[model samples]
Target: MNHGTEFSRRDFIKISSLFLAGSAALSTLPSGIVSGLGSNPMNGKGEKIVYSFCEHCFWRCGVAVHVSDGRVTKITGSEYHPLSNGKLCPRGTGGTGLLYDPDRLAHPLIRERKGGKQYYRKATWDEAITAVAGGLYKIHEQHGPSAIAMLHHGFGVSFFKKMFSEIGVNKIAKPSYDLCCGPARQATVLTYGYPSDTPEGFDIMNSKYMLFFGTHFGENMHNTAVQEISEGIRRGAKIVVFDPRFSTLAGKAEHWLPIKPATDIAMMQALMNVLISENLYDKEFVEQHTVGFAELWEEVKEMTPEKAATITDISADSIRTVAREFAFHAPAAFVHTGRRTNWYGDAMQRIRAIQILNALVGNFKMPGGVVAFEKYPLPQPPPAHEHPAYEKEVHSKYPFFPKDEPSNTIASHEIVQQAITGEVKALFIYGVNLPETMTLGRQTALEALQKVDFSVAVDVLPAEVTGYVDVVLPECTYLERYDDLDNGRAFRTPFVALRQPAVAPMFESKPGNEIARMITDKWGIHGVFAPTVEAGLDKKLKLAGSSLEEIKKRGVLVMPATDLYRKPGEPLNLNTPSGKVELASAQLKAGGFDAVPKYTKHPEAPAGYYRMLTGRKPMLTFGRTANNRFLGDLATAQENEVWVNTTVASKHQLSHGEYVHLKNQAGIVSEFPIKVKVTQRIRTDAVYMVHGFGHNAKELKWAYKRGASHNQLISKTDIDPAMGAVGFQNNFVTFVKEI
Candidate 1:
């Protein structure tokens, strides 16, 4: 079967049976299964059981690692895991491949000389640590501590950020805020005074209506949301999807509105207009729980359904039908937050408009509706002793630093760019890959690295950003590390899970926390690393009012809470200046953005040009899983393909499965194997492709030279004025057949 094609129920069952049979066979084998049992050297059944979390992506699902004779035998999701529910995503299932990857950096390597292509031979941990610390100290003494910057990626990044601050480096950044979830978070903060966990828990099982605006939960593999969505469907929830493309989620939706791309806000405004004009909204909720209804009503009065129809390309009648359905559904309605919101200049506003729709339907904080509640509890450590040196230094450098700097630095992308231009230095990158994940003009980031006297990247894989680093530290994967699981913030069912090292570090790789301890020791700082991960668990236990040993033995912990809902006549205190869900934002006033969620015309493509959009496939995470042989083999190519509509393909005489060169407004062009998906399902003016292709790493033999980089075509745009996020979807490009 083609990898991209869907599997029927019968095929799915067959695949599941095969997987179960394999698991049963593996389980029945002796605990002493070793390398001699199979052709693969790493294939082994070891006696030691390592319980750890999968760090492949942020889902952080629990897994049991079977190690036989120091080799990982198999990886599977923990059936006992409450979050993952015994099913692992493709990335999680392929975790072992990463452990035994041939291309993995096994030891510390340093550049032979500045700007040199050749690297010196691998060195011992002691030698590497000494060189890295010494280099950073030397740079700090000469240029001040601000000469360095740090860009950390994945979870457990707090330890590194603390170390950098202790050493007096003020510059820090992560792609999380810029490339991924920044806009949604910013919008949440602006409206709620704090960032609400997105796709925020919906009582989907009981919901009667679910409206998705650009949310592709089914395909994104957010375990909880996907499970809930499926459950909701089983219960007969009306799922409506609004997007420009026929997304996987849209395929399942009862109504799929192929609106013009980047005009989601306009559609949302039109919905609001209909609800208000027809008096179909929750009047009681609006009158009692909200404060700015009058102001919002005045602002949206001009935006009639007919006016919005012209801007959004949806008929006014259709808008009224959906609006009436949502309002009539009452407490069982929700809107979901999807990934990749850093698309258009008004992305945050677009989300805000969608969120406002939920408020109009009286769904905010209600069961079977859009809800907000505290996460499950976990054992937390006692607060660390203050390192006055670090405290005083950080305050002096970053005067506006929030009390919780790591959690508060949502705008770090802009800060990192400023730091690169010598505005701030002293960078420490813990686990993120900035060069590949950030927006266009990566050369500027590279230049920023060059300008900084000290740069450090600690990652399991030696990524593109690591090549430009002054120090490249080998960090162990989650399988070899001890970390705490805090599900108390996102899930209503409070729980604490422990990640026990399934095996000892295979090479000289150290856990990030251990590395952090070394840095603190070198600087004469103390107490950051507990005697054991169990001791750290004791702290979280105190927070949860539970015993540490009990949590460890149970492997999982849950705190059940009552289903809470918003009280009657309570104010809908959305944190916007108006206190109501703002149809028009007062916050965007200074930024020169339209206060109303109005649709602006997308950049007109010259005669032959088309707008391009990017999406994800189930087999990959942004650039991370392309190296897995088992998963990679499931897809013929990892490159971004131009999914042209049938009309456009015929007009251009483009054939399916042909090679093409796609060029953008900035003159950057990428060549790729094109697969023209001709269907009325897509809009004629646009084309869709998958991201994380266009691998440039020669070291990744299988992935290199396969796909085209979406970044190449994204440079000719500006940041969203309201949120400072890169407008990745605003580019216009032309596709040419590769002769």
Candidate 2:
């Protein structure tokens, strides 16, 4: 159960910085640590196993790691944990390749530019940490802490969030909710007291019917949800999906509506209209739990199924049939709150429309409907400050989403725009691959990075972001680190799970806590963080009358099960101001936003242009797997083809498998010319591609120039009125045959 260290050729070793060495057991180690590191074999020809969590994606499935002689040999789903349930996806199984990626940052590197060329040189840990502290402090003095903005990604976000808050930096950019899930959360919270969408909230397993839009759950492959879907299907739950492509989930669904892109709102409005006019809504539940029933009906009376048919191109009869079927199932049916919902400017209204349908059916807290995710009072380290670190956020256009406040996030477009103007002078990017993920183009990202006086990137592999930074600090991969205790806030369970290092930190890399401490110490503020991640877990465990030593032996501690669903006739309280389910939000109306969901037309692609869109690959999550050799051999990597409609291809005399060049409105051509898959699966006016390909960093040997970057094709974005999230589908592109 003990972990060790794998030192690099720097001829330096320091276990004191890594707070994991705190214990009476470490007293048994050799007094001379550096002499031991050069030839140390902690495993000593014996087998070792450890329990940890997957770091491939945010799902964070519980995993078991088997280390043979200090090298990770295998990783599999833990049978005892709820998320994994003894099943692992392609991403989780391929984690070992990421841990041993040859492209990994071997040492601290300083971005050195001489004459006309830019290059990197190896730097010692001392030199790099001092540069970071000095550079950041310099910016703080000249422009105040707000001049430094950050984009926190991966599980290490909590560390940066706390550090930035302590430094009094007002702009610690959070992108996930605001840019990825903002609309869904805001719409859900505005309707109910809390968010209607959580990883554990919806009882998809017990449902009789389910509906989806945009999100492809089967293709995304969250182990727990995939397992739950299997259970639901076995019980005869009818599934329906609406997407531009015939995704894996669409193939499995009883009905797949190949609606036009960015038109999910129109279809949903038509469905709601039918339910209201036909008297299919739950009259009893509406009277008991909500307000503004009549006004809601009045607002949507004209949005008939036929009118929606013209907008979404889904037949009026098909729309009416699905609406009736959904309503017929009553409280046993669900409208799935989808992920990756920030596709259009009207995203919040669309999500609100979907959630409103659920409330109208009286399905909010039922066993077969959407339920609340329970949180357990676990042990933890005390806060750095007595009260909250940040003040109440100022009002925005759609000031409703507060799962993690949207106002706190620097908008995808806003961050770069501000950075280009020298308003944001320094940036400390943690785990975020901004060049690939965010829109407004790869050029925009580089320009923003260049505009900053100081920029530091912390990562394992040499990503596109690394080429844009002034300094790069190599961080230990999750396999060789201890992170915050895995509290099941996102899952259906109330438990505490540990993420222990199965293998020693490779090379000169350090874990998140150690990195945080080093920077904070040099930055002259060290009291903000607990001494170690384990210490924080111990404090949390002690509050619950448990100890870290007790959980360490077992690996996880699941609490007694409690009902997450509301029972019949149960009185409940809400986080909303009025403490009631708001069918019409007073807060929204007060803020001059539409209280009821409304459908507005989105901008169409130019006459000769095709709209650009993106989706996830089950084998890869957000294309961060580009550097993983195992994933590169997983079939899709070789074919990394752009999906063009057969009808559109014919007009341009293009054929399948031919390399096609895409030119966006901004005149930026894709970095890689992609093989075209001319098929009927996608819409005629739009082309699709799996995101996370076309990484241009030559250091990333496996992923460079492999496929195409969706980010490269998108030069402009529309911000969501609700949360300042980027509308990812706003860009348009035209084709050029790469003959």
Candidate 3:
């Protein structure tokens, strides 16, 4: 264990010889070694192959796990997969280490008393189930089922929804909407009349021109998108990137327009003006497939490149050039829908504007451009049962729910505040880490936990949010669980895969679906939860017309081949009210937002302060994978690095790798180590940092003090007026030297 001890020459020779012998042995092993020990470097001996989906970030790429005697040896992308094409990102490969992590919760834990800081000894499954059910019954008896809120996170989500519905708790929330992808989905639905879940696939490989506005498909590793985009560029497609920082995608782009932060809407509007003024838009396609063009024309007529230059700080001439190129490119041009649109106020409107621009060029639903299609295949199941008694007890406050937001729409910050105010009596959180994900301060969520009567968190590791829970239940990683891959919508192919347990669950951990089933049985709501899961699975299988057991055995399934693009006169059903891609959305007007896509001035950063913009790092997947030793070791410091522009660094007299305190408008400051990325590629008025850092949890020993949290420097001052999405980028912060 002593790392510093020097080795003798003889000892060094012995070590080198052993290593060479091991390498030689590995070379002689079979390609698919079934054992842990083998000559092949890629394969191990006695390895049990299991199919599963990656949960590192939500691409849900199919993976194969190599398990040996109940231990997962390695994880690789399913070579037989039709979507990922046998490719796995670094985060997916590192997921194996998470299963055997020392910090993983081994058993259920409960607080000794209400509002207590310390937890009692680990309890048995029966005890944990009984306690949770008893607490819910108590809260129901006193207040009502409405007092109990179920906050679900991550995959296997439909299972939780069934449990909450059966248990008669009508209050439910998910972190996805307000914190991440909500704005994009909501905007797409409002404008087009259909949810963005069935996103229009971008034919990057076939396109001649691609425009990216803050959408980094390469770094985010959206399997199909990344592969296609890269191929398209190699085949001579021109890529233009518009962002405040030189993102990984921007670096590979043909042109990088490093505009000021939050100025994307202005740039897009300017492009629209150019297309209209020059008469370069697709006239035939627009007249046939769109409505409200006159209204859109009237609104955009005044917003010329010259007018937009004042707000966006881009040269008018450059905007005109890009616009003409994109419009004239016709069938070979596309505007990609970027992830993480829930970062600023009016983000929904911003996305609508971008999508409208794509439609103006007649790029919608065409090959070599943006095309609309259906992708996911459903799995098979059993039968349905009833829970009439429980159904009657459901809260009426959420009757409008699953109607407007079929998905959970409650914001994380608002849920925490309600818990603190005693509006919520009980909460069960699964998979997500609210302390790190929520825009509100960590202390605010912790205080909310203190006020709640009961809280249960099921996770792989004892995250910071676990400290605030009444019960902490350990859940198995993807490598040791059974999951269906049919849930994801394929952009490039029609395929379905199965995620079988590669190894038995480590310790007492269980799959999230199984856990939900157990809780359902305990609450005597078997009729509801049992039938729902069975019926849902059955519906999926019938859709595929395949046997569930056979699909499980094969580990992968593919639906009958269908046209990837929809044909004309196919009874196209647009989710928008007008039943077409709306150039001007009526829903926005009803919601008090601009009906026509219009650009607004970006919020100005205060003097002496920089607009602190946060995004993902290539190495890290939010805050979840930071605890993995293999991935953590790849970076020198296992935390976030604040990237300061050389201009700003010089102004502050700060050097690279120095510690600094990032102070926000609300006076909340986070002290973190900084790294100066001195490049003219980033805007001088902005500072950049990767999100999912700044761990305050004492239990995360490796991540505790590694980096500063960008979330800490973001105030809860701005929210998207239309959809209540958090304005994370609206924040302005000043960096002070840390003494």
Q: Over 4 Å off in model 2, which ranges?
A: 1-45, 196-200, 385-398, 401-409
State the C-alpha lDDT per candidate.
0.65, 0.74, 0.68
Per-residue lDDT for 330-397 in model 2, tens only? 69898987877778777777877888889889888787787887666674656775424344232344
Higher lDDT: candidate 1 or 2?
Answer: 2
Model 3 misplaced stretches (Cα beyond 4 Å)? 1-45, 113-117, 198-200, 377-406, 488-490, 527-543, 566-573
**lDDT of model 2, residue 59:** 80
**Residue-by-residue lDDT tens digits, candidate 3, 306-414:** 9888877788988998998898686789887777776666778787887888889987767678665466556335434433322421123222112455346455556
- The deviation in Å at residue 232 for candidate 2 is 0.7
- Per-candidate TM equals 0.87, 0.91, 0.88
- Compare the candidates by TM-score and give the number of the best one: 2
Residue-wise C-alpha lDDT for candidate 1, range 284-373, written one tens digit per residue = 776655555666677677777788788777787778888888888866887766677777766676666766677788777786887765
Highest lDDT: which candidate? 2
Superposing all C-alpha atoms, what RMSD in Å does each candidate have to the true structure? 8.9, 7.5, 9.0
Q: Where does candidate 2 clash, by residue pair?
A: 379-540, 379-541, 380-540, 623-692
Candidate numbers sorted by TM-score from highest down: 2, 3, 1
